[model samples]
Target: MSAVLSPGMGAIEQAALRSDRFRLEREGDWKRLDAIVTRIEKGRAKGLPDEDLLALPGLYRAVASSLSIARETSLDAATLAYLEALVQRAWFQVYGPRSSLGEWLAGFIGGGWSAAVRAIWIDLLVALAVMVAGTVVGWLLVAHDVEWYQALVPGGLGETRVPGASAAVLRETLFGHTEEQGMSVFAAYLFSHNAQIAILAFALGFAFGLPSLMLLVQNTATLGALLWLFADKGLLIDLCGWLSVHGTTELFAILLAGAAGLHIGRGIAFPGDRPVLESAALAGRHAATVMAGVVLMLVIAGLLEGFARQLIDQTAGRFIVGGFMLAFWLAYFFAYRGRRQTAGGHFA
Candidate 1:
């Protein structure tokens, strides 16, 4: 025979009954929600039927409420954990970001890169002007005094043609020096050297873009002086053929990078209506994409200068390759982009 329980004991017994009743009332819904949430995780909600999908947010809210009530009522640990886990998964499905990596990549390729280039067109034009001016000055200086060749061109790059070299010597260097060892060494060095300049031009824009401007001038000046050297040797056509293969892309890549740096500098130096920091941050976001593309261009330039220049010794062939690449880039950026933006707008 059992002893008689006191009123407080009876109240404790009833509270336990109430907690059990709460779990019993909600257990089925919790399990169903868990199943749907699991399916969502696996299938990304694609397999979920309409009703089941519609019910998810409701179920999520129900589970959240249940979790709160369980904590307040001091429910069993197992039941609380079950509800907590369910709610977590459901919350993510309902409220977290909805984009996938594939979607973002597709969007970026579709219009993001080109759109960014178009946005900074003015800065790019200015950068191009600066480079052209530098080239002209370099050409004039070298033409006036051949000694300036020693000052403008690096010792390594100058190894092929020098201050007092004859036309015969430059011809030998240009058309005859396709020997394996010399060509290999020169190509490797040239690619590595230009890559450094390309990266530096963009990186140095922080010094009020002045440093980048100077670098552009120096690079262009060097080209001009080299042109004069080849022209003096009566090998201007040959030199043009050699450079045409990769110079178009390489020069454009460097200018784009310089433009990126300028964009950042302008933002910081003149934030206009916004705060300096915020203006800079926004400009950086846009310029960074252009810089990334510029790096890609440099890599292509390096490859053309390396293997193509080595194998295709004909000047005509080099020009053809360069022309094709320029045409492709122009069409990709303008033609394709313009088709989408009609007189009003339309895709061709």
Candidate 2:
């Protein structure tokens, strides 16, 4: 004869039966997902067929649904635990990052940085205009009043680079004697100074980019003041040649930094339909990538400033080097088409 059961015991028995039935119905898909995920995790998925690889996502979603159902229906403890584990493992294989560090770096250099730069084209244009205007403003200020030179040029250059220095003195400063041993130190110092400026420009982007634009204007204005001083002595072309060696790279880096800041500022200032914080975060990610590349540009500029500018004394040679670099950077950022493209069919 069958034994009698209490009410609680009867309920438990019915639940266990339902859990067993549920597992049986879905266990095949669960097992398939588990096998695929396992193969990938174990580095044995290279030979996995296209069909199986394609099926993996579908299988994962089905198992995830099963897990959710089990929890809601109060399935047996063992079944619940098993589905939880399976779903978690499948989630990683289905959605986790698959690239190694080397792969990531290669992609970033090949296309990611350039794509990010293109994404903020509007901001870049604004920054370029601001820089050009600033330089002109600087020249006009010094041209109108010679006394403005002292205020615009930094104090370190006052001894030799004042407004009224003789042509001999100004020429000597350009083709000055150099200590080979001090070249590295000088390069390091330039790098440090440029890096500081770049960092400040990027960091100040949160205040709607006003501060970043001001910083750019301030830096370029100094450049304008120096240009006027050289132009006054009829050495405008000579000064251009002298600065071309490294100024191309250095100025480009600053331009990008200012643009990155402006991108963030624009995001916050005009968030559109998205929440302000979310829009800022998206812009920040793009800006951060651009800034990372800017650091590399600054390092190159430093090397050119410290060594190439010193070693290449001829005006023509300096322009050649500088022009080649500028061409290279332009092609790399805007011309190269890589394997990965964003939604708009541009490299990313």
> Who wins the lDDT comparison?
2
All candidates: TM-score = 0.69, 0.77
Instruction: Tell me how far candidate 2 lies from the true structure as C-alpha RMSD in angstroms.
Output: 5.8
Tens-digit lDDT string for candidate 1 (1-348):
423445667776766666678877888888889999898788656667899988888989988999999999888787888788889888888886445666544555566557677777877888999999999999999999988988889877746578678888787665654555433666677777777777888788777778888889998899899999888877899988888788878887888888888888888888999999998888887788788778788888888877777677788988898888888776765556532221111122
Give the Cα error of residue 172 in candidate 2, in Å: 1.3
> What residue pairs are clashing in model 1?
342-345
Candidate 2 weakest ten by summed lDDT: 339-348
Q: Output the lDDT of residue 185, model 2.
A: 49
